[model samples]
Target: MGEFELIRRYFAPMAKATKPALDGSGLLLGVGDDCAIQRVPANQDLVFSVDTLVEGVHFPLGYCPRFLGWRALAVAVSDLAAMGAQPVCFTLALTLPAADEAWLEGFAAGLAEAGQQFGIVLAGGDTTRGPLTLSLQVHGTVPQGQALRRDGAREGDLVCVSGQLGDAGAALEFLYDTAPATDAASLLQRYHCPQPRLELGIALRSMASAAIDISDGLHADLLHILRASGVGATIDLAALPLSPALRRIKGGAAAGFALQSGDDYELCVTVPEQRWAAASRELQQQLTVIGQVQQEPGLRLNADAGMVYSQRPGFDHFSIT
Candidate 1:
């Protein structure tokens, strides 16, 4: 099948299905265009971010196409979530080894489901012949002055993360059979179907002092906020959130994963003490306070006697072997 034909068969319908429902909203033009046009509402600033995922590096050798479709878009939109942006639309660039019809069908179905979930539409994209890789550029918008930024953290701000951590890390073990358990559905879901903290990020608008989505491991991504704001933090080890599945199935690695596992897609935010109560009420117990921002310039973990300095690198795509 030809490229345009492939798009028509699988992707064009996604755009067409949602076009009329929009009734001339944020996305003006979608699909079959050299460029997609969108309208930004007054007092809102446009936000854009692109993410690329290659087979093997980003996923297993033969991950489910449908889940891959959802995950690819979820990870990209997580950037918008981090910035307190409401997802608008996205463009995709897919490279495949072949025009596998079955793969395309499942992948498109998954993509469509995620699009609906995130309230985003597919604008336009390209398909090329090569090693399988999915690149998506997501567009969003945030209120002019309320966009969350990483450089606004202040001393005494509380560091918080949404949802329990370590589930994804435990799930990774099962993917390769490195861990002994085999009946971990929730952990596997954590790995395959990461839920981006979109609502929480949007709610964080003026409440959070600074924020970032935890794409890398919790420690690694939180370090980004600290560095950007020129601040430091002290995280209590006991306060790290661990899901029941992770604690029960992969107990030994629970702490490690919570501290260093990647792909959680949860939000790590810093909010001032005065705002903590308001933020707490807003989240409605969906978040946990794990640490506190400080004037010092390093990350510390609480220990029995004192704080332990840590500089461990998170998942690095280009780590030296």
Candidate 2:
């Protein structure tokens, strides 16, 4: 199919599928237009983020198209979750080496599924011929003056993370290693289809002193909050949450995954000591207090033996060998 035909057949339908959610809403015009028009609701501010995933750099060259479609959008929307914003809509710019009909079908299906799952609509986008790449821009809405930020953390705030960590990291390690292992399905799922913690973020809008999604490793992403808020943190290594699947691995390996692995799309939040009870009650079993914010201006790790220092923070795009 030609470029226009490819878009009309696959992408246009995905945009139209969101019509029910956008009808008479903020989305004035969606796909098939020169520009998508949207109206921000009163007393609300719009949040925007863009992310790109390139084959061989972000994922394996022969990765599953469906999972790639879901992950490409999920990572971008995780930024909105960090700000405690409800998803509005998104635009996808897709570059493909070739318009393989089967691949496009699976990709469109996955993209549409994600939109439905997240309650976001595909508004508009562009398609071009190139080495495989996917770029997505997502928009979300949050109440004025209530958006969560990394800079809002303060000393004495309780550090918390939603859900388990290290599963995705473990999955990556297993994929790259020659180790023989059964029952990798769960870990692979975690790596491929990350669930963005949008609901938890919304719930913490008033409760969290600061918040960030763990797109990078906890060590690196937490430092972002510390640097922005001009504070420090003390992480209890023993307290880091690990999934049962990850726990099946060696403890030291799991800890390394939790500390240095990226792409776990979970939220790390800071709650005031006094507010911890309330936040804990609100989040129920999903929240785990892993540490505390400190007045000092660097990260410290509390281990069983003694305090340790982090040698590397996270995956640096420029520093990757």
lDDT per model, in order? 0.86, 0.86
lDDT by residue (1-321, candidate 1, tens digit) is 999999989998788654433444588888987888888877789999999999988888988899999999999999999999999899999999999999999999999999999989898999999999999999998989889999999999999999988777668767755444544777888888888889888888878989888888889999999999999999987788888877776555456557887888999999888887765565748779999999999888874443233457877778956
Q: Tens digit of lDDT per residue, candidate 2, span 1-321?
A: 799999999888777755534335567789887999988887899999999999999998788788888888899899999999999899999999999999999898888888889988899999999999899999999999999999999999999999888788778756654453664667877898999999988988988999999988899999999999999999988899887777677455566558778889999999998777755555757789999999999988877654233568578898866
Instruction: Count clashing pairs, candidate 2.
Output: 0
lDDT of 1: 0.86
Model number with the top TM-score? 2
Q: What lDDT is reached at residue 132 by model 1?
A: 97
Pairs with backbone N, CA or C atoms under 3 Å apart (clashes), candidate 1: none
User: What shift in Å separates residue 242 of candidate 2 from its native position after superposition?
Assistant: 0.6
